[model samples]
Every structure is written in C-alpha cells, then in structure tokens.
Target chain A: MTEHTLAEHTLTATDLRLAYDRREVVHGLSVAVPPGKMTMIVGPNACGKSTLLRGLARLLAPVGGTVELDGRDISTIPGREVATVLGILPQSPAAPEGITVADLVGRGRYPHQGWFRRWTAQDDAAVNEALTATDTIELAARPVAELSGGQRQRVWIAMALAQRTDLLLLDEPTTYLDVAHQVEVLDLLVDLNVTSGTTIVVVLHDLNLACRYADHLIAMRDGAILAEGAPADVVTTDVIERVFGMRSRIIPDPLSGTPMVVPESRHRMENSA
Target chain B: MTAHAVVAGVRRRARLTTLVLAVLAAALLLLALSVGTAVVSLPDVLSTLAGQGSRATDYIVLERRLPRAMTALLVGAAFGLSGAVLQSLLGNPLASPDVIGISAGAGASAVTAIVVFGAAGPPVALAALLGALLTAALMYVLAWRDGVTGYRLVLVGIGLAAILLSVTSYFMTRSQVTSAQDALVWLTGSLNESGLDELVPLAIALTILVPATAISARALDLLAFGDDTASGLGVEVRRTRLALLVCAVALAGTATAAAGPIAFVALLSAPIGRRLARDGGPALLPSALTGAVIVAAADFAAQHAPGLPQVPVGVLTGAIGAPYLLFLLARMNRGGHGG
Candidate 1:
C-alpha cells in the first residue's frame, strides 16, 4: 500500500446562482465548507440542496457568481488539477456494461494520467487500496453488472475513494440503500474523514442521519439556508418545521446523543393514535 | 493484490484476441490478392508484391487486385473505428455512424456531386466530407435541448437519414441513364473504381484520426459513468465530446467518399469485435481488424466465387447486418434497453 498524507483544501461558494436551462435552481447561495470537517446538507426534495452541491463541486456552472477553491476562482483552475484536489460522486452513476469492478474503479486514476502516461505501479496500488478500504477486494474480478445493489454501491464508493482527493463531495450517496447499508456507507465516510482529515460534504435525504454524522449541519428550503451550525444547534423543532414544513419534535438519539427529529404526521395526534 | 492480477489477465486476453484477429485479416487479404480469373498462387502474389512477378502476374496483382483489396481493407478499418468511437460515445450498441445517417449524408452528397455537377474524383470526395460534417453539426444543433443525450442524437440522426436518402433518390431519377448507372454502382458502395485517388487521402486521414481517437477514448470510458461523473473526473466534457464526434464524422465521410458508403460495415464491426475480444471497453483496434477481415473476405467472394454472379461486397454485408439489426431491435423491445 502507498502512504496517504492528510490533505487540506478550502472550498467556498460565493453568492452562487446556478440554473438548468431557463429555470434557476440555486439562487445567490453563499457558503463556506469547513476544512477537514464533515458537512451535511439536508432539505426537502427539489429544494435545490443537490443543485447547491453541484455548484460547489463545479459540476454545474453558476450563472451569477463564482466558486473558489483555496481562495482562487474554481473556473480558472484546470479540470484535472481541480480533480486531483476534489473528488465528487454523483447519485446513481452507471458502470459500463460488462465492466469488471476493478476496471471500473481503476478509471478513477484518469486525473493522474496524461496522453503519454500508461498505467503505473502507483495506480495499481491505489486501486488495490480502494478495493480493500471498501471491502470490495474479493469482488474485484467480478463483472459490475452481476453485483448486488449494495455491493455495486460499494464499488462506486471505492471508485471515488481511488481518486484520493482531499475534498470529497457526495450527492445523496445513500439512495436505494436499505437502513443498514445507509449506516454502513455513512460510517465509511466518517472513517475517511477521521483517518485522513478529508473535508467531506454530503447531501442526504435522511435528516436524522445527517444530524448524526455531520460535524457541521445546514438546513435549506426553497434555495435558501434556513439554518447552519452544529447539528444540535441547527436541527431544532422550529428549524425542522420551517425547512421540512412539518411539525417535528427534536430529541436526543439514545446511542449517540445526536439531535434526532421525530416528525408529527396525521396519525400521530392523541385521538388518532 | 488480486485486482492487479485480474486486470493484467484481462489485458493479456485482449492483446491475444487482437493478435488473432489481425492474423486472420492478413490471411484473408493474401487470399484476396492471390485468387481471381488469373489463377495465381500464394507465392505468385507474394512475389508480385515483392516486385519479382512476371509482367502479367504483376499487372493482375499489383495494378488491379491490390488497389481494390487495399481500398476495401482501409475503408473497412475506417468504418469500424468510426462505429466503435460513436457507439462508445453514445453508450448505445446501435449508435453506429451508418445507422445514425453520417454515411447517408456522405452518400447523398457524393451522388449529388456525381449526377448534378457531372464531377469525378476529388471534387465528389470533398462534397461528401462537407456533407457529413454539416449533417453532424445540424444533428447536434437539433438535438440540443440544454444538452444532447445519446437517445436524442440517435433519433435525430434517423430522422435526418430519411431526408438525405430522398435527396439521393431524386437526383438519381433526374439524371441521364448512363450517369445514373455510374452513380448507382457508387451509391451501392462498389470498389471497382477504387485506386490511388481514393487510397492516398484516406491513408493520410487515418494516420491522423486514429491516434487522436485512441487518446480521446480514455475519456470515453469515464463517460460511461455519465457526464457529471466524467466531468468530476476532470474531463472537459464538451470539448472531448466534440473532438470525438469530429473524428467519427470525418472517418465515416472519408470511407464513404472512397467506397461510396459500404452497407453495414460501420454498423457491424464494433459489436462483432467486442464479442470476439470479450472486452468491456470499446474494442476499436480489434473492430478495425474485424472489419478488414469482413470486407476482404466479402470482396474475395465477389471476385472469385465460381458459378455465382459477382455482386458488390456491400450486398453480402447488408444481408447479414439487416437481420442482426432486427434481432437487436426485438431484443431491445423485450428488455430494459427499449429507451
């Protein structure tokens, strides 16, 4: 295995205005990603949570404002150079048909290669390490199409891990996963964050899981931030009601003592129950 | 540890398959050079190639058979590589250059240049190249809706193909019968008139385009994960795509200019190559080799088959490819690939 040094990167979006065709999705949103910490963004569906993540990662161009990485405009940086510092895994990325897990994961080395550069020993080491880290080493020889859903998701995560970027962004990485698999994936991210001090950002649908895993939490609604702070400070009953538009109670998780939200629904009233 | 070994194994298998296909193509090429009404043997063909044959043998092998075989081989390779590139880029098995109207565009312009302009040689070739590039540009424009997906491009190409074929038929009907006879043979993709006029320009184009494609194809792999993931991996998505599409269009156009759009060579090569090499990635080199073998064998049959009328090489390939297309369509309808 190769030695991996802890990495530092500061990514900030300043008044970002992102759009798809004619409709602006994320409007004038400003946020700074806390370096070396795990940040989670949560909100209701179609509220531009994913769009903001896309803007921060430079996957979608901001129509109105600039995003900066290490205090420089990200658009000015060469794509491969930016890729070496920051890796992003979009939700539901498809693997090529008949591609082996190893080959699919090995493609993450694209950023490190040039037109003249062939595969090297370091690339192999990185791929091996990624497979081992994701516990997918045994499945490396198998066709990706043949893998179970949870295993395929792990392989995608392994591919992202192989990028070895300091700033890693994932957009709803836990979709299509069961409750157990979701926790497993989140735990894996925590391990990466703790071990390498990688600045990690995640867009999550599960608000409670977001609160449990995040060192910094952000709640958004209608393309604007409702609250941003530590999970305990940000995931309040009022904040949840405002962001999610549902009456909710905030309670401490029994296992981790993290803020947990219990949303009140039609059947939760005393007479209905 | 196991991953490295596994990848190395797969690479070895691909290399072996490519070598085997190359040898097969070479063997078929020699057979094409050797046999005809002349009844020359392998040694005679090899000796003729080495400039040691008797005058008659030399005339038969070098002056006549050699040019046609070389055209068929190179044209096949051009169509094959073009198909492999476009299919990988679009992420659809049926997204070959011929199926997507690039070949039709080239043929339509070549036919027009022949019938309308009374042109021959280089002028028609230029018109075909321009037509292919313009059609590709038009397709990209029409398919653009925020962005062009593979599905949209494929549909738009099919629509354009219909229009281009009509333009070809109209020109054929309005022309003199003698010119129509000439145009008809070229439109059906015969190599009877193939010579240095076609071969030199094509060879030069391949020398440049093939290497460019090999370099850009690295990005094509990342694109299999979709545009956002590919961009996140540091590919300049739009630029890379445009470069590849340019290569695909130019290759198809050049080959069509040379041999008048040989039916189904572009549509057939990549899938056959992929299955032969068992590669997950687009087997471009292998496809080129497979295409060379297909056309060389088909042309040899056209030239030397006893008791059979000599048909154009395109007829044999069209017969094979049309059925395979129907099979593919049926399979797609019954599977998740309907879209």
Candidate 2:
C-alpha cells in the first residue's frame, strides 16, 4: 500500500451550535482538532461526543458558526470535493446484503469515480491494498454478514481507508465489539496513523482505551470541551472526576506509558470503607 | 494462460455458457412470437419474417403477432428495471414494484377509471400513473418517521396493496358484467392484442424514462449501503432517493397501464439479474432484459398450459413470484439479525 503523505488537514469549529428538531444539543462549542495526530473525544453517554463528531464530518450541519476544513469553510465546499479529502464511519456501518469484502471496500471509490468510469485497474489496486492493510485479503470473497465482529470492524475501516483521504472521522466504532475486538480495531487504527500520518478524530467511551490510543484527548461534558491536550497532560484523576463525574485514581500503563484510570466506584468500595 | 489455452479456461467457458443461454432466450422469443393462439407454423413464420410470404402470413407476422411480442418485451423490461431499482433502494428482497403496492395502485386506479368514469379512451395510462404516484406517496408518508427504513416501507406497502386490492374487488363487483369481464383480463394482465396507439405511448415513456434511470444506477448502488454512509460519501441522499423512487413508480405505472398488472416480472427479474451479474450492485439493463424474457415466456406458457382455463399471462408470474417471496421471507426469518 502506498501511503500518501498526509498534509495537515486541520479541522476547526468557530463557536459552533448544533441541534435536533429545534432543540439545542450543542451550544456555542468551539474546538480545533490538531492535524496529523490521533485525537479522541471522550465523555459520558449523551454528552454530544457522537453529535460533535457528526458535525465535524459535515454529516450534520452546525446550527451556528462554521466548521472549517483545512482553512476553508466546510459548508461552502462541494460535498464530493469534501469527501475526497475527508472520510467518515458512523457508529453503525451498514453492509449491503451478500456483499463480499473486496466489493464492499470498492464502494469507497464512489467519491472518486465519474459516471462514465467503471472499476478500473487503479480502483482494483486500491481495494486490494485496503484489504491487505486491514489483513482481510484472505477473506476477500467472504460475505460481510458472515464475518466475526472484529473482522467486520476491520472491513469497515478498510473501506474508509480505501477512500485514500488525509483525514478520517469515526463515531463510536467499538460500540458493539468485545474488549479484544475493540483493542484490535484501535491497534489497526494506530498503525494506520503512524504509517500514513492520516489525521484521525474518533469518539471513544472507554477512557483508558482513549488514553492509550489517542495522541491528543478532548474531554467533553454537556457538549462543551472540559480539557484538551496530550493524554498524560489532560487525563488526570481530577479531570476525570470533573468530566465523567466519577472519582478515579490515575496511573501509567505498564507497556505504553499512557495514563490509565482506576475508577473509585462508591458502591464497590462503600463496605470496605 | 496462452491465447489458445486461455480460450479453454473457466472464464472463457463461463462466457460461452452464457452466450448459449442468451441465444436460447432469443430463440424462445422467436418461437413465442410464432406460436400464439392461432398456431402459425415455424416455416410460415420464418417466411413471413423474411418478407416472401402470403399476405395473410405477412399480416399475421407484422401486424398481429409482432405488436403483441413487442408489448410483452417492453413491459417486461420496464418491470425488471423498475423492480431491481426498488429492491436495491429499499435494500430488501421483498421490495419489488408489484409487492410494494405500485402496480396494485395503478391497477386499482385503472379499474376505477374504466368502471366509474366510463373512461373509454387511452387516457387510462394517465389514471394508472396517478394511482402509482399516489400509492407511493402514501407508502412513504406511512413509512416515514425519522426516515423511511426498508422494513417499514415493505410492511406498509403490503398493507396499502391489500387495501387497494379490496377496493378494486368492490368496484369489480359493482360494474356491468361485460366491462367486468374485460376488467378481469386487464387486472390479471394480458397481451391478447394492442394497437400501436396504446403501444406507442408506452414505448415513448419507456424510452425517455429507462435511460434516465440508468444515469442514477451508480448513485442507487451507493444508496444500498444505507443513508448516512451514502450521504457522507457525497451522494445527494434525498434527491437521489426521490429521483430513483420516481423512476421506479413511473416505470411500474406505465407497464401496468399498458398491459394490466403483469405478474412477477418485476419481482423475479431483479434477483435474476443480480444473480447473473453475481455482484452486489443493481444490474439495471441485465435485470430489465431478464424481466422481458420472463414475461414473454410466461405469456407463452399461458397459451400452452393445458387443462387450465385460458389464464391471463399474469397467473403464471404469480405462480412463480409468490413462492419466491415466501422463500425470501423464510430465509430472512432464519437468518434473523445476522444480516
């Protein structure tokens, strides 16, 4: 796989407001995702992590302010042009029934194709490259519906990678996955970022996983950023207590040297105390 | 593989196999054109086609049988293309033009036009189009909440189709016996005869609409991946869907108006086309051709099926289409949430 040199495609929000059905979900939120880095947005459930991710990807329009893509206003950019530079995977990635891994990955070329161009040699090359990168080339012809959760997750990521964009945004990609599958997907993503310098902005629920996988962390509460910095700099017990409303002790991971939080659950420790 | 060696390879063998099948379909179409109710012999049919036959044979070949064959071919093509688009758009096997109430709505409206308004003109096509559009609109409204999901659309279409069919039954019972008999052939679908007057308008509509639909084929393929992903990939989600839905309804409406509601062409053709292509994307032209082949063959079978009272061509399609639907539903049930 030929890794395209990732030019920093900075995504910034200026005083963003987002809502659904006239009810505000995010209010005057502003943040910038530092380009050429893996950034994780972490928060409690319903705290607008997914919504913010959606707004960043331009899948949802901000009710107020502008989302800037690489210094240009995202709303002004043609959707196809925007897609050529930015790709997104929602929480649930739907697969067409009976579609094989290779064919599903090939659909990521939709943004790159014109009406007259059928799949060419280059398209097939990209599909094969994505499959190999995701370690799914052996399962190229297997129907997506028959794959394991971890395998399916890789297939979805491979599809995103097939877009060959500088930036990728994922919304809760590990929601239904087991712990092992979650780690496997996160590891693959890390490899992708390291090898290609692809800017990744992801929403994650597990704080420890977020700290381990992310180079930069954005902690959110009620649609606003609580703190943003390197995992070691931002993922302190005090910050966790404030953002997640849970008392926790912080320690470094033995292997990765990333901040690891050991939550102090009141119910579990009450009898001992 | 060398040039001559590759010619003997599996890929070459597959192509050769399909080429033979395509030739067989062509031959069957020719035989069907010849052996209608009048039983014109193959030699006479061949001579007539070659334009060196008696005036009676020439009249039968060019004027009488040719139009009927053309109607079957065109109507079948429309159904196949429309059904394939609908199935892929709705992302379910059960969602075909006929099963999803588009055809039923057209049939019901055409029946009403004939029975109530005493509409004695070719304007029945207009009524059919109106009925199809209205039915599709109602199905969308009923299915829509946040957005129209595949499961919801099919379920609501089934209910809507049942209601329309009942209304049609009521109208048939109230109409005069002779008009009712004519309505029966129209409802069950027939190609007994069609003048150029009826065939020309349908041909024109198909010509304008089918190509327009092909232009949206890639967009529809993206759509089958589901709404959010399609939109993120730069497909104009609402506009693409509306355009495809309009094309499907128009195709189904036009075919129904031209040939009364023909059976299973829409339902059977798309899956067959998908199988033929052996890929996930909707194969519009191949599906349309399969549809034409199916309807023409079914019409042929209607003439030949012995011991049965002369049934409408649609009866054969229903006999095939209904079981396929059941099989899809059973398979879905068995698979549960795995899909």
Candidate 3:
C-alpha cells in the first residue's frame, strides 16, 4: 500500500466566475492551492466556498476563466484521467440501498477500471488499505445503512482514500458530526496529508477546528478571498468578524499553540460578573 | 471479510442466479413449444428444434409455436432490461418505462403512424422508438426544476401518459374498423397476432440495444447515489445518462411496436428478479430472465387456461402489474420518497 512520493500538482483557478442559472454566485476569483499542505477554506454559509470547491473538483463548470491542473486546462482533460490524480468527497453523499461498506468503498476505484469491469487484487489491496487507514476495517462487512453517523462518515472517507488521489478536496466534511467526531475526522485527514503527502483542501464551518488543523488558511466572504496564509496571519479578529459577521477574541490553543477563536457571545459579555 | 472475497461472493451470487433463471426460461420455452392440440412429444420437439424433423412437425414448431414463444421471450427481455435501466438511473423503484408512461408514448406514436400515415412494418417501429424518446424527454423537462425527484417524475409521466393515451384513442376513432382493431390491440398490449413481422424486428432491436446497455450501464451503480457523486467518480454523468436513456427508450419502443405495449413486463421484472437473485443491486440479467419467464408463462396460460377465455398476453400481465403499482405507491408514500 506504500505510495511513491507524488509529484507536486499545481491546482489553480484564474478569474473564475460561477453562477447558478443567471445570478452570479462567485465573482471572478483566482487562487492557487499550496501543494502538499493541509489548506482549509472557511467562511459563513453561502459565502461561495462550496461553489469554489465544486469548481476546483470539476463538479461544476466555470462560466468564465479557467481552472488549470498542472498548467493545463482541467476541463480539456478527460474525466477519468483527472480522477486518477484528484478526488473529491462532497458533503452529504448518500450510499446505494443496502450496500456493504466494502462494496461502497470499492466504487472509489471506478476511474482506474476499464469499461469491462474486473476487480483485481490490486484494487482489493487499495480498498483494504483505505479501510485500515480510516479505522473502518471492522465494519467492512456491515451495510452502510446500519452504521452510525460517525461510522458512516469514516466509511465515506475510506472510499475517498481508496481513490488514492494525489490531491483531495472535501466540502464541509464535518457538518453534522459532534465535536469529538469532527476532531477525529480532521486528525485522520492530517495523518493522510502527512504520511502520503496528499495535497488536501477542505471547506469548513467550524472556525476553531479549521484554525487548529489547517497548515494553510484561506478566509472568504462575499464570494471572494479576503486573506490567505498561515492560521496566525489570516485568522485575525478583523477577518473573522468580516467573514462570519460575529465578534470574537483570538487566543492561542494551550495544547497546540494554534490560533483559536473564542467567540464573544452576547450572553458571555452581558452576563459575566 | 476480505474486499476481494466480498466482490467474488457478489459475483458468484449474481452468476448463480442468472444460471438458475436461464434454466427456468429454457424449460418454459420448451413447454411453450410442446403444449397444444398437437401435443408434440419432448423428443420430437427437440428434434424439430434441431432441424431434423418431418415437414408436418417442422411446420407446427417453426411456423406456429416458435414465433409466438420467441415474441414472448424477446419482449420480456427488452422490457426487463429497459425497466432495470430506468429504475437504477432514476434511483426510484417505481420509475419503470411503462409505469412512467414511456410505453404509452410509444403506443401513441405507432398508432399515429398506422392510422394517420397508413404506415406499417419498419416505419411503425421507428415511430414507436421516436415516440418513447420524445415522451421521456418531455417528462424530464416537465418534472425538472433544479433536478428531478422520483415522485414528481412519476406524476409527470402519468399526466403525459394520459394525454398520449387520449391521442391514441382519438386516432382509433378516426380510423376504419380494421385500423381500429390494430389500435385496440396496441392499446391493450396484446401478443395474439405476434409473428415474424413482430419477432424479427424485436429480436434485431434487442441484439443491438442489449449490448449497448450493458456497456453504458456500468455507470448505473455509481449514478444510483446522485449526479454529483457519479461525476466525482469520473463518469461523464450527462453523456452516460443520455446514452443509457436512449438505449432503454429504443428497447421499449421496438418491443412495444412488435408486441403492442406489453404491460407490467417491464414493471415487475426488476423487483422480482432482484428478489429471486437475492441481490440488492440492479440484478439486470436476472431481471431480463425473470421477464422472459413471466411472458412465456403468461402467454401459455392465456392460450391454454381451462376456465378463462382466450385473452391477449397483456391481459395477464396487467392483472398482475396494476395491483403491484398501487401497492408500490402506497408503500412509497409511507416511506415518504425515493429521491
């Protein structure tokens, strides 16, 4: 299951414009994903973060400009060819009815297959490796329908892992998970980035978790990027307030010394002695 | 279990189910040929099929029994494959072609060709194919807002079916009695007049369509989840959908043109095949075989049943399928939705 060190793949969007029907959601924007780093895109609801992720993953076509993968126009490339080096896990993807965990994860090997489907030992090895990485090996025989929310989330991650892409994108991977499970999923992603050198990008809802986990941080508001750098540089009070429209105090995490946001809630301020 | 082991197990089960269904279909085919007023013995029937029989036996087997039985099997397979494709692609159990009025669309078009243009043969078959495709496209447009949902698709299909059925009826009323009889047979979906005129075209259509469906339909398992997920997995989602949809519509159309819109053969074959195979996935091969068995058996009964009068093959399928449709709607309602 050992992967050779991946060649740095540059994923970039230049003056990208996105729209739903006629009303433009994301204005012309440009950004480059840092190769081999854990980059997280954080913003409030409908900030076009998910839309940008969709365009980056080639799930949505851009209305203007281009998204280039390794200096080539991504849309010009064949879908299966692109899928070999880049994979994305969309938020709230559902499993087919009564599908076993192993079978669902096995679907991640789709791009690598010929039109005449033949499941090989190599595919099986990749699936088994992914199940192990996501700590879902025990549930491989279980139906995805019977799994708990957190377990199911891990199973989905395992499916993405089986794809073995050099760069992976996820949109709101932890939207419905509780605090502990969210942290667990993040830690698992970090391990993947560190061990396999996968270029990882995520759209996150939780500010503190995004700050703590991301090596590179991008702050977005109103369909445009406001700041991007290390967590300490881009996650300041002004950016947080502008992005989320909330007041907050920035503090160092005691455990990791990462920049963490302590939201100054109205209840906290007025009720304190 | 190991992942490959699991895959192997699923494959084994699918293969085993297909083999069993094939045997059952073959046995029924033999029975269909042997049973009648002549009561040709199994050996004689076998020898006749092998092309080594006397002229009298040859006449009965090839001229009389073979075409009818062949029609039943081919129509069953076409509808079975078409329904499996629709149900899987739309991610709805109730989205069979007939259930969604695609059959009615084909019926309307073929009738229009017959009564209005005085057309027959290949022209009528092409008309049916065009009709089915247009109706499916219409249903998609009417039902689509942001994306299609199963309930809305089914509802839109029923509305389309009603309008198309009325078109068929109007054409029937305007035509002469002979043409009206033709329209009536199509409207009711009968196999009584099935012959080489029907069987040859239906067989050729399936021969082309089935392989095309087999290749394009590989995306179906991925598509069953959602469009986003399917595209993410490297499937050319729109292109794949269009190709598979066309194959299904053409199959349904040609079969309808040949057999007069055999009802419920497409509808029940899928679930029955899935259940029989004991597989949760599409079980497409099993579904096709299940369809063949249903039609062969239904045709046999329609011809030979002691108490009942001679009826069209469709009458039996409708009697079985109509109730299942109600039960499915009731259950889908209870479950809230499929999409």
Candidate 4:
C-alpha cells in the first residue's frame, strides 16, 4: 500500500441546531473534537448523540450554525472532497445481498477514485490492510449475508478504514455485539488510533465501555453537552445524575483505571440490603 | 479464499455469463429469423444478412423477420438495463419498471393515443415517452416525505400502476371494435408489425441510455447500502438517483413505445443475471444480455411452439413471470428480505 500522508484535521461544531421536520432534535450545541484523540459521546436514549455525530459527518445539515473542518465551513466543501478527508460509518448500514466482504470493503475506495481511475493495486493494498487490521482477512472471501453480527460489524469498520481518511466518525459501532466482541471492536479502533494517528470520534451507548475506550469524554443531555474532559474528571456522580437523570456511584474499573458507573436502582438497593 | 481470489472468481463468472448470454441471444435471434413459414436455413439467413441471397430468402429475412428480431433484442435489453438500474437505486428487487408504473404509464398513454386520438405510429410513441416521464415525476412527488425510501416508492408506484391500468382499460372500452383490436395487439406486446421506423428510435435511445446506465452502475451498487452510507462513501446520492431515474424512465418508455411493455422481461432479467454471475453488484451488461436472450427466445417460442395458437411474446412472458412474482411475494411475506 502506498503510505498515505496524515493531514491534521480539526472538526468543530458551533451553535449547531438540527431537526427532523419541524421538531428539533439537537439545539444550539457547540463543541470541538480534540485532534488525533479518541473522543466518545455518551448520552441516554433520544438525547441527540447520534444527531450530533450526523452533523459532524455531514450526513445531516445543521439548521442554525456551522460545522467547520480546519476553520472552513464543511457544508461549503464539495462532498467528494470532504469524503477523502473524513470517513463515517453510519449506525446500521445494510449490505447488498451476496456481496463478499472484500468487495464490500473495496467500496470505501470510492472517494479516492474517479470514473476513469477504476481499481488499482493501491486500492487492493488498502483493502487488504484494512481487513488485516480488523482481523477480518480470514473472512474476506465469505459472503456478507453469511457472517455473524460481530463479523459483519468488523467488516464495516474495515470498509471505513480502507478510506484512509484523517478523521473517522462512527455512530454506535459497538451496538448489537456481545461484551467480548464490543471490547474487541474498541481495541481495534485503539490500535488504528495509536498506529495511524487518525482522529476518531464515536457515539457510544455503553457508559463503562465509553469510559474505558475514550481518550476524551463528552457527556450529553437534551442535545447539549453536560460535561467534557478526561474520563476521570467527567465521570462524577453528579455529572452522571445530571446527564442520565439517574443516581449513580462512580468507581474505578478493575480492568482499566477509568471510572465505571454503578447505577443505584431500587432492585439493586433492596438486594444489597 | 483470499480476497483477490474471490474477486477474480466473481469477475470470471460474470465474463463467462456475459459471453454465454450473448451467444444464446444470437442463436435465438437466428432461430426467430429462420424458422417462420417458408422455413429458411441458417446459411440462407446469414447470406441474406450479408446482402447476397435468393430473392425469397432476402424478402423473408431482411424485409420481415430481421426487424422484428432486432426490435426484440434492443427493446428487451433496454428494459433489462432500466430494471437493473431501478432495482439497485431503490434497493429492492421488486422495483422493476413494470411493477413501479413506468411501463404502465407508457402503456396507458399509448393506449389513450390509439383509442381516443386515433393516433398510430410515431405520435403514440411520443405520447408514451411523455406519460412515463410524468408518472415518474408524480411518483417521486408522492413518495417524497423527507426523501424517497424504497418501501414508500414501491408502494406509491403500485398505486399509480393500478390507476394507470384502469385508465387504459377504460380507454379500450370506449374505442371502436377494430381500433380496440389493434390496441389489444399492441397492448399484449407483439413483434408482429415491428418495422425499421419503430426499431430506429428505440435503437437511438438505447445507444445513449445504455452507456449512461453503465456509467452509473458503481453509484447504484453503493446505493444498496442506503442513502446515508452511500453519501458517506462520496456518492452524490440525490444527483445520482435523479440521473438514474431519468435514464430508467427513458429506457422503459422507449421500449414500451416500441413493443408495448413486453411483460416481465425487465423484472426477471437482473435477478437471473445476478444469479448467473454470482456477484452482488448491479449486473448491468449481464442483465441486458440476459434480457436480449429472454425476449428473442420467448418470441421464437411464441412463433413456433407446437399445439399453441399464435400469441404475443408478452403473453408468454407474463404467464411465466407472474407466477415467479407471486412466489417471491410469498417468500417475502414468510420473512425473507423484500428489499
């Protein structure tokens, strides 16, 4: 594979407002993603964490303010140009029936190619590397329809990796996976970040996993950021109560040195007593 | 089982399928040309096509069957390409032009022109083209909530198709018996009166639209992943869809104008092509070739099948395709993926 030069990318949203029809989903939110770091957005259901990710990926146009990439308004850049710099994997993308994993991953080369450019060896190398990185090289020849849920998710991540972009955004990449597979997926992302210095942002539902994997943490509620900082600083009992509307005890994870939330529920309290 | 090996295997299979389909289409075309009343031999057909044959052979091959055979090939290919494009664009195998009211729109308009306006030939074809375009626009408008989803588009198309079919039936009921009989033959999609005038316009349309379809094949493949994924992959989803829709309508319209919506060839060709190639992407060239082979073979069967009365090729295709469609619907209802 041709070694792609890593360009510095900065993604920031200012006063961003998003809506589906007339009903607003995300209202006037401003945040900047730390460059070359793994940032995780965590929030409860319907809090617009996915919507914020969509805005950053340019999948949804902001209703009020602007999202900027390196100080230029992102909406102004042509889609293909933006695509070469940023890669996104939506929450749940359907695979065409009967498509092999390699062929599906090769689609990530779309932005790097033109009508006449066709497929080249460089593309093949990129695809092969992505598959290898995701540990999906063994499943490359299998049809996507035949893969397990975890395998399919890895194949999708490999597709995004093949884009070879400086910035990658994933919306709930670990959903629908077993605990082992979820950690496996997150570990793959960490490897990518450490080796390639690719800036990564993911919207995650699992609070403990988010804390364990995030270099920078963002907690959100009602489409607004409640707290943002390192996991240790941001994962306080008060912040968790404010953000999730649930009282929780914060404890250090035995596996990782990050704060893990232990929710205080009636059933749990009764059992403990 | 390496990625390269798998990709190469698919490519090889697709190429082999294309070659096989091309040869089958050619053989069927020759059979259709040679096996009519006053049965000419293959040699005579070839000589006549090369511009040196007996007067009888020349009149039989060049003046009569060649135009019909060529019309079958071109119109069928056009329909196939259009169907493949639509199916991939909407991410539903059921989104063929015939099912989604494009051909119905053309058929409705052409029937109206023939019955109400007493129109024949080129004017009817022009009417069909306009009708198909208008119906596509209307379907897009009706299906658009925020954006057109495959499910909504197919549902809206089926509704429009029902309305157009009723309009066509009403027009037939109002026309004179003789005029209605003429419209009936056209409606059943016979290759009986296929001539150079009809063939040339469809040929021109295919020449332009076929290349356009080829160019958009990659985008169509990406679109199967849904609009958000496709857009994230750098496909200009809306623009690509609009361009593809226009191409699909023009192709289906031109084919309908020529042969009155030869039933289900478009609907059947892509899936068959995909199966033959064993590839997941939109098999444009393979589908087109498969369609040509199907129509040419169907026309031959319609003309020469023993103990069967003379019938339009459309009747045979519809008889064959409708059962398959039902089977598909049953499977989908039983929890198979419909889209």
> What are the lDDT scores of the predictions, listed in order?
0.87, 0.83, 0.86, 0.89
TM-score of B-chain for each predicted structure, in order: 0.95, 0.87, 0.92, 0.96
Candidates 2 and 4, the one with greater TM-score: 4
Displacement of the residue B124 alpha carbon in candidate 4, Å? 1.3
Off by over 4 Å in 4: A1-3, A270-273, B38-40, B47-59, B336-339
TM-score of 2: 0.90
Q: Write the per-residue lDDT of candidate 4 for residues B44-135, one digit (tens) a residue.
A: 88988899999898888988888899999998898888888888888778899899999889889989999999999989889988989999
DockQ, candidate no. 4: 0.64
Ranking by DockQ: 1, 3, 4, 2
TM-score of each: 0.96, 0.90, 0.95, 0.95
* Root-mean-square deviation per candidate: 1.9, 3.9, 2.1, 2.1
Which candidate leads in DockQ? 1
Q: Which candidate ranks first by TM-score, i.e. highest?
A: 1
The better-scoring model by lDDT among 3 and 4 is 4
Per-residue lDDT of model 1, residues B130-192, tens digit only: 888888999999999887898999999999999999999999999999889888887777777
- List the candidate 2 regions with Cα displacement exceeding 4 Å: A1-5, A178-180, A267-273, B1-25, B36-57, B305-309, B328-339
Model 4 misses residue A34 by how many Å? 1.7
Q: What does DockQ give for each predicted structure?
A: 0.70, 0.35, 0.64, 0.64
| TM-score of predicted chain A against the true chain A, for each candidate | 0.96, 0.95, 0.96, 0.97
lDDT tens per residue, model 2, A1-273: 443657557899999988887788888899988888999999999888898988888888888988999899998888788888899998888887777777788788888888743656666677777887888887876788999988898899888988888899998889889998899889888888888888999999888999999989999999888999999999888899889898888889998999999888757676444
lDDT digits (tens) for residues A45-75 of candidate 4: 9999999999998889899999999899998
